[model samples]
Target: MKSTITVSKKVKEVLERKKKEMEIKLNKPLSWDEFFQNIFREEEERIPKLTEEEAEILKDLTKEDRKNWRIREFV
Candidate 1:
């Protein structure tokens, strides 16, 4: 299936400029979906692995913070 919708000349020019920028940045042109996918994939790859202590801290974060809690005791 094919469909076309008219856009303003300014909008078309902006799109062309953005396309050229993206092509140069990525070293190749990409479809809109491909650009988003690459961004998400890069973000997912950059997430740090949680340590045991960090995991425990995340698990222990209660609805309210308790006073005088021992951090080393939990560790």
Candidate 2:
């Protein structure tokens, strides 16, 4: 299916400018999704991986935070 979305002209202009900048930066033009995805991927790559201690602490914190418990049976 084809779809259309509406944004303010200013927003569209900014996105077009960003697209052009990314095309020059990456040496190829990309669709808006591709352009944004590349930025997300780059940002994700820059995030530090959790250490063992941090991972364990996060796990414990999440476990402690869980409150509701439920069981379901279906026939």
- Which RMSD does model 1 reach against the true structure? 9.1
In model 1, which runs have C-alpha deviations exceeding 4 angstroms? 31-75
List candidate 2 segments past 4 Å from native.
57-75
TM-score, candidate 2, is: 0.56
| 8-67 per-residue lDDT for model 1 (tens digits) | 999878877776787798899887667657768878989988999988887677523555
Clashing residue pairs in all predictions, respectively, total: 0, 0
lDDT (CA) per prediction: 0.75, 0.88
Candidate 1 clashes between residue pairs 3 or more apart in a chain or in different chains: none
Cα-based lDDT at residue 71, candidate 2: 68
Q: In terms of TM-score, which candidate is strongest?
A: 2
For candidate 1, the TM-score is 0.40
* Candidate 1 lowest-lDDT run of ten: 62-71
Total backbone collisions, model 2: 0
